[model samples]
Target: MRTVRIENLPNRSQMHELYHGRGSLGANRMKKILVVRIGALGDAIHALPMVNELHRREPESEIYWAAGPSVVSFLKGHSALSGFITVNKGVKGLFNAAKLVRKKFDCAIDTQGLIKSAFIAASSSNMVIGRAWNSVREKPASFFYTEKVEPQKEHIIEQNLELLEPLFPNETKFEIKYDIPIHEHPEWKFLSETPILFNIGGGWWTKLWERENFVQLANRIDKVLGLPVGIVWGPGEEDNAKYIAAHSSAQLAPPTLFRDLAGIFSKARLLVSGETGPLHLAVAVGCRTIALLGPTAGTRNGPYGKEQITIEPQLPCRPCHSRTCADFRCMPMITPDRVFNEIANKLER
Candidate 1:
C-alpha cells in the first residue's frame, strides 16, 4: 500500500461532475449512497454510527457499504444498510474496484483515509468525500478524494460523523447507534447461564495483554465472585484462548460469528478485553465492560457505553502505540491483582 499526502491530491474538480449530479438529486431525488470504510476491525465498528445516521437522514435512499472481507460478517444482516460490497485487499481488489465503479453510486464516503481506500473511493464514483490523504500517517493517498472533510477533533467516531455533516441539517442532533443483531447459538445458550465473560484476544498481538495474566485474572474473579467465567476468542486466537481456558477456571467459548459474539457480550454480566472490535461491540450492545489498554490510549479508543471501565497502566512510557514490542513492559505493569481489584470495586458499586 503506497501512501499519499492530502495537499498533493488531484484537482478537486475531477469529482465535480459526480457531486453536482448527486447534489442535484437533492432531497427529492432518489440516490444511491455508497459508504466506504475498509479498515481494521475496530475502525469498521466505529464507522457504523455514521452509517446509521446516513440511514436516518435519507430514509428512502439506498445505503451501501464497502468494507474488507473481515468485516463483511458484521455488515451482513444489518437493518440500516441495504447491501455490502466487499473490498478484498489483494490482486483481486482491482477487479472488485471495477465492479464497484459499475454501481454508479451518487455519493462515495471514505471513512478510512488510506491510499487504497481513497483510490477505491475515487475509482468508484465522481462524488468522493474522505479525510485529507496527507492527514493520514502515510501521505500521498489524499489525491484521490473529491472532497476532504477535516474533523474538528481527533475522536474517530466524531470524525466519521463530521463527514456526513453536508448531508444533514443538524449532524450533532443524531445519536450514535450500532444495531448488530442477536443470533441464537447453542454455545451462547450454555454461556448465558454463566455470569462473567472475558474476551481474550485483540486484532493485533501488540494490543493483546499476556494470556497467562488474563487467565489468572479470570480465575481470581471466579474465585472471589463465585461466578462461572468464559473466554471469547476471534479467528486466530484459538490457541491463546485454549491456553487461557486450560490454565483458568473459565470455560472456552466456541468460535462465534459476529452477531453471536454481540449477543453473548450483551447478555454477559461483565466483559473484560483489550482495545479490540469486540470491546466496542460490547459497548455498542450495552454491556458492562472493563477494557484493558496497552499500546493505545484509552482516551482515544476506549469503550464508549454507559456501563464501562477502562484500566490503563499509568507509566510514562505507556501508550507507545508500537505494533511490535521488544519489551512488553506497559502491559506487564498492569497486574492481575490490580485488574481483579477494579473488577471487585465495579461489581460492588
Candidate 2:
C-alpha cells in the first residue's frame, strides 16, 4: 500500500515569492505598524535599530511602539515613532492597553518574545509577526503569531531585526545601528568631561561585579592613566556607587535618566560594567566598553561594536544564566588588572 506524504508550509522567502503583489502585506503597503517590545531597558534599546530601519524603509507608515511604563520615557521623542501605547502595571493596565490597540494596525511585531508581549501584538493587529516557538523566550508567545520567524543571527540586536524579514522580504542586509537622542542632564553635565566611568550595578546579583573590584580598578586608573574616574548609578544603587567612590579616586555622578545617560556615553572615553542596561546603552551611544560578562555570554548579549571589549570568565559554569547562584565566581574572576590593561591599551591606540 502506498502512503500519502504531507509537507510543511512555505518559509518566509517562499511566501514572499508567492504573494509579492497579490494582496501581499509588506511594509510598503501597510498604513500602520506596531512594534511590541515592552521593558527591560536593555531589550528596549536593542529594538531601536529595527524601529529605525522600519521608518527608514517605509517613511510614510506610522510606526508606533507599545512599551512598559519604565521605558516609555526612553522610547519617547524617537524621530521614527508616531506615538506610544504605554503598558502600565497590573491587570487593569493590560486590559486598557488591549482596548487601546484593538484593530489599530496593519501588522504587529512582538520583539520581546514574551507571552504578554505576544498577546499585545495579537490584540493590536490582524497580522502578528513574532519569533518561532523555539526562538522565543516563552514558547507560548509564538502561538499568537500569524507569521513565525526563526532568527539566523546570534546578537540580540540582529535577532530583533530578523523579525522584519516579512516586512522587507527583498532586503537581506540591514544597518544594525542606533540614533539615540542625547539630552544632557543639567546636574550631570560634569559627566561629559569625565574620561572613565564605572556602572556599579547590574539588577541581577549574578551579573554584578564585586564592589571592591571597582575600587581597585578606579585606583589603578588614577595611578596609571592619570584620568578621572566617575561612578554612574541607578535607583537603589546609590549606596554602592558611593562606596566605590569613597574607597577610591572615583567620583559619584548625579542621578540621571536615559537621555542624560546617553549624553555621558557620547563623550566618555571608556566605561566599565557587567552585563546590564547601562552597558548596552553605552554601546548604543558609541562609547568604548569593558563588559564583564558572567551569567551571560558576550557573543549573544555583548556590545555590538567591533572595538568594544567583552571579558568573560574562564570558569566552566560561566554562562549559567542564573539570576541567583550559590557560588557566583564568574564576575570576580574578571580581575581589575585585566580590565585596566584593556582600557590602557585602547587609550594608547
Candidate 3:
C-alpha cells in the first residue's frame, strides 16, 4: 500500500457531505465504540481527526474516550465523544478506568500503541484493533490487539485514520478534522491585533531549544518584524516566559488554559516553537507555525499545514526520539538568525 499525505486527503466537511449524500450506514444499528488514546496533549490532539471521522461515518454510535487527566480540560467538550473516562496514573484512577472498561463494546481502538493503552482496550472489549508490532511504539502492545494493522501513512494523523479500516473497510476516503473548544477571554483585549507568538516549552528535555535562542529570536523579531511578540507559557513555565519577556521586546501573555489558548492561537499571526503540545495546539487552531524539531521526526509529528515549516538538524541520529541525550547538538544548530529568516519569509507570504 502507498502512503498518503494528509494534505492530499479531503477534509471532514467534504467527507461528511459525501457520506451523508450516499446514505451510508443507517441509524438502526448504533455500535458502542471505545477509543483508547490516553497520552500527552499532542498525542491526544492528533487522535481528534480519527475520532471525528468515526463519528461522521457512524453518527449514532456511542463513542467513548479514555484519556489522561492532563488532557481532560482540553478534550472534555468534544462533540464526537459520547463520554470521557479520565485515567490518571494513580492506582485509584487506573482501577476506576479498568472497572469502567468492563462494560463490553463493539470494539476498542487503541491509537496510543502503548502497553497501558492496549491493556485498557483489552479490558474494554474482545475485539481490540491496534497497530502491528513493528509499527507500534511499544512492540509488546501488539499482543493485546485482536486485529493488528500496518498503517501506510507518513503523518501520525493519517496513521490514526488507518485504524478505522476494520470498521469502515469499504470506505476508501475520510476527512481530517480537529474539533477543539475555542473560548474568548476578556483579557485578550490587551494583546496586539496580530502578534507573533512563541511557545517556549517541550514535553521532553531533548526537544527544547536553548532559552537564550528564544530571547535572541524575540529581540530580532522586535527589531525587524515590528510585530508585538508574546510569550505563551503553560503551568510551571512562568519563569521561562518572564525571562524571555524581560530580556527581549516580547511580552508575557496572561496564564491561559487549553480552551483559552485556542482563542489566542486563532487570532495570532504566527507561532514559533519546538516540537511541543502548544505547537500542535497552535496548528490545530489554524495558526501559522514553524516547528524547530530535534529528537522527533517532523514527517510524523510536525505541523499539519502544507504552508507550515519544520526546521530540523541534519544529523545521523536526528530523530532519536529520546527524552534526553548525552550531547544535545541538534537544537543549537537551529540558530535565531535561521528561524527569524523563516519567520520573516512566512509572514511576508
Candidate 4:
C-alpha cells in the first residue's frame, strides 16, 4: 500500500501547465490573484513590497489581501488590492472566509508562514504558494503549500521577494520599496525646529529595553544634544509614555492614529526605539532611526538602509527569541549613555 501525504494540498496549476496558455480554460483567463499576509503591523508592512512587485508586473490582475481585523482599517481601498477579507481566529471569521471558498483565485500566496495563515490561503485556492521546509517559522505550514520555495536571505522583506519567483521567470530588478499610506495626514506636523520621536512600546516585557532608560535618553537628547524629544505610545502603553515624561524635558506626542503616526515618523530628526512595529514604520518612511535590539537579531529585523544605527547586546543568549526572561539581564546591557553617544555622533555628522 502507498502512503498518501496528508500535509500536501492537491496542485492543479502544474497539471495544466502544458495546455493552459492564452486561449484555454486554464491559464489565459485566470488573472485574479489572492495575496495573504495578515496581522502584527510589522509583518503586514513587510509584505507590502510583494504586493507592489506583483502589481508592477501586471497592472490589470485583481489582488485580494486577506488581513487580520486589527490591520484591515489601513489596508482597505489600497490601490494594490481588489478587495480586503477580514480573517479572525474565531468561528465568525472562518464563516466570513468561507463565503469566498467557492470563488476561484488563479493563485494565492501565503507570505506569513503559520498554520492559521496557511489555512486562510488553503481556503481560497488549491495553488497555495509558501516557504519551503527549512525556512518557515512553523514547519507544518509548508505542507499546506502546493508550491514551496526555499530562499537564502536573512531579512524578512528579501525572503518575501523569493515567494514571488514562481510567478515571474528569471530574476526581476525588484526596485520599488514601500507603499505610502493613501490618506494625506497634515494633522500633526513637527512644531519644533529639530524633533526627535521616541517609541515607548516594544511588544512584550523581554523586548522592552527599559522605561527608565528611555526617560534618561529623552532628557539627554534635549539637554546635551539641544533637540526637542517627543514620546509616542500605542494602546496599552499610555502609562509608560507618561512615566517617561513625568519629571523630564520630554514632550508627550499628541494622541494620533496610525496614518498620522506615519507623518510623525517622516518628520522626526531621529527616532529612538527598541524592537517594535513603529520602529519598522519609522524605517519605512526614511526616518533616521536608532534601533535597540535585545532578544531579536538586528540582522534579521533591523532597519534596512544607511540612515539608521542598530545596537544589540553582546549577551550569550542574545537572539534567544524569548518573550519573557526570568532574570531579564538583556535590557540592562544597553544603557542610555551608549544609545546617546550614537545619537550625538549622528547629529554631529
The best candidate by TM-score is 2
Per-residue accuracy of model 3 over 169-280 as CA lDDT, tens digit each: 6777988789888888777764656889899888788888887999999988888777888888888788888998889988888988856888899889999999988888
TM-score of each: 0.87, 0.91, 0.90, 0.89
For model 4 the local lDDT of residue 128 reads 77
Per residue, candidate 2 scores C-alpha lDDT tens digits across 188-295 of 655656679898889899898889999999999999889989888998899888899889988888888756788888778889988899999999988999899999
**Order of candidate numbers by TM-score, starting with the best:** 2, 3, 4, 1
Please give the TM-score that candidate 3 achieves against the real structure. 0.90
- How does candidate 4 score on lDDT? 0.76
Off by over 4 Å in 4: 1-11, 14-30, 98-103, 182-192
lDDT of each: 0.74, 0.83, 0.83, 0.76
Highest-lDDT candidate? 2
- For model 1, residues 257-287, the per-residue Cα lDDT tens digits are 7657877887788888888888888888888
Ten residues in a row with the worst lDDT in model 1? Answer: 1-10
For model 3, the superposed segments whose C-alpha errors exceed 4 Å read: 1-27
Candidate 2 lowest-lDDT run of ten: 1-10
Rank candidates by lDDT, best first: 2, 3, 4, 1
lDDT of 4 by residue, 1-349 (tens): 1111122223585424622342233334446677777788788778878888888777876777887776787666566877777777786776666455434566778988888778778777767789998988889999888888898788888788888776664666785467657343554544345588889788877888778888888888778878888889888888889988896888888787765677788778889888888888888778899998888888888877777899998888878889988878887889999999999998889
lDDT of 1: 0.74
